[model samples]
Target: MNEQSLNLDSQKVDETFFTVKLPEQVGLSDQLWHLSKLYTLGIALSYTYVHTPFKCPRSYNVGYFETVIEKSKSILNKFTSINSSSTDKLIEFIGLDKHELNISDQQFELCNIVEINIDEILKDDKINSTSDLKKCIEYFGLYSKEKIYSFVTKGIYKFESKIEQIVRSANLDDSTIKKLKLPEKYWKAKEKFSGKFSIDNSKVKITLHIRKGDRTCINLNGKLVSVFASSIKVIDSTDYRDELKQSLMDTTKAYNLIQEIFNKYGEEYFSVQVLSDGYQRTFFTIIWAMVRGKIKLNLNDLKQLHKTKKALSKEFNDFLRFSNISLVVGESKQNLFQSIHAIVCADILIITSGGFAYWVHNFFRKSNQPSLIINLNSCDNKVVNKISKFL
Candidate 1:
């Protein structure tokens, strides 16, 4: 009648004493001398036969899970339960269906349970559901739910830390951080955003008909639609003015230096190699550079471009270390697993220096010379090549 009588004890007695083990135990302690001999086998058989699925139910009383299911039902119950049907439904409001929301990640967590089974009427003493709970106490060194709950809550508090790292590493503005409701502890905005412009869709026309204020996106007929705010950074006329001035200075300086070096070497060491990222400006600069100099680099022209076909790859990375360049860019576009925007900006700037080292093969092909050149960060660190014509 009591709780213990119903579940384990009764069932266990039925199998251990009344059935398989009992027959083996029947007639053995001497008259049934074999009974003692077989006692070990009987216990093993009893355990296997009676206690097959060693499930440790969380509670002896099913009420605990009953309560859980009730709670789940309360929140999820359809028209069949307490909440009545409504024209304005949550599923409709959220634009989703009941089957779609498995929002709970509970299944991903470790199972924390007590004994395998518990009936409400069967007290903990009767069914001893506390065995698994006792295991939890030993494992966690905390017997009370309140203690375990506090420890777990502390662990979850770390969730706040990760948000700050995301914010800082993203280089987000304070206002953006505030808007995201992120705490500052975890976000790390270590990366910078480098910027560069490129001519997209090279075949796209830029005819004289394309007025400064014209909608370039238009077809020949001009239906006056598909107006996209052109993302191309249109260089102002002033860009050429500055470039021309620099070109004059940089070109003259570099030419004079090259001339001096050439006069000393006299076609023996006098070699030149033109490097470009396939940009028209770089090509133009190279052409103008040759014109400015009375000297002509005969026998070769060195032109190498990456297979990527992009004017500049996303950014430069430590790969330049092998080439002896230290390039740092502010671009955080992770399209590149290695380099960033900082590398590109640095490269472009370095063209002011004597330009990149002449790669040996490139030198041999372009000019009859043996030079080791790598575009490590040559463009960003030096204006020598970029502005040799002006100087």
Candidate 2:
């Protein structure tokens, strides 16, 4: 049947109905970001749902978009029919057995399906530059010509000027948005948190999130950290890699910088927290620099050193022992949600440039605290400023 046969207005159906199929392997934060955008678009257009290969983990405790769609069963059954083998593979990939499949009747099959390439959508000139919702919808072919009468009757064309406001003030009454705003478990766990480091609520916690690994563009360079060292006066040259490396390795400089920050912020009211991959030598070196003279050797520290002895480089293993600091060691081993929670709770935050950091600064952070952002990506300062305004 066609859209005209649907009799949308009499049935109280919105002008259009569609399901957006999200590509697989997108990161968690990125998936949420896209979903947030789609949520706004869905409200502006008609009933919308998302079909994603990845399910939101139970730890997040948020319902996926499909759970809220009125006719999710119909949508999924049709989707499965269209891409049968691929759907089976995806179900298997997520470890869902055949018994867990929830396919239902296609009695309410009135929706169109759109495979959304997030990158392409973002790159679309109409979407990127204009605030015209209808124009965007037409550009993306997200409507049924058979439902032309409903579009006109529903005054969809009249919403062009108010698109920006509609998008900005979109009612985020969904469970996903609510759960993200106040993650109860994340905060509850903070009381008895037992991670690589403990949260000290007594002091002004300053979290430094240094992005490393495959994302090299936004990696926190040694030179940037050396700027805090008052005793080190290395000339600013085009390439200060050698000088920066030496300065970081120099424990005295790290101690001097830490002392300066402690004195300035009040030793009793200041604490430093770091979130990054633990396997990097720079991570060990930086930790050693901060705690070298402050913390005395302990038995637990010895045990931790032995545990991570083989994982760390010889020099960094020695550094950890000399500094009396212990760290959870592995590639990308840090818990992202925990780090995000720490960032939100921090009185002051130091972050490197990236989409993840930008989103945290914009949507998740509720406090109007001071932040020192290292822009390594030559990113638009205006974009950063705009994100900060939202916080």
Identify the leading candidate in terms of TM-score.
2
- Runs with alpha carbons beyond 4 Å of true place in candidate 1: 1-240, 247-253, 277-391
lDDT (tens digit, per residue) of candidate 2 on 98-194: 2111212143233333333333333344553234444554555545442211111111223333433445544433333432332342344344434
TM-scores vs. true structure, each candidate: 0.16, 0.44
lDDT of 2 at 231: 20
Candidate 2 lDDT: 0.39
The RMSD (Cα, Å) of candidate 2 is: 14.7
Clash tally, candidates in order? 76, 0
* Local lDDT at 24 for model 1: 14
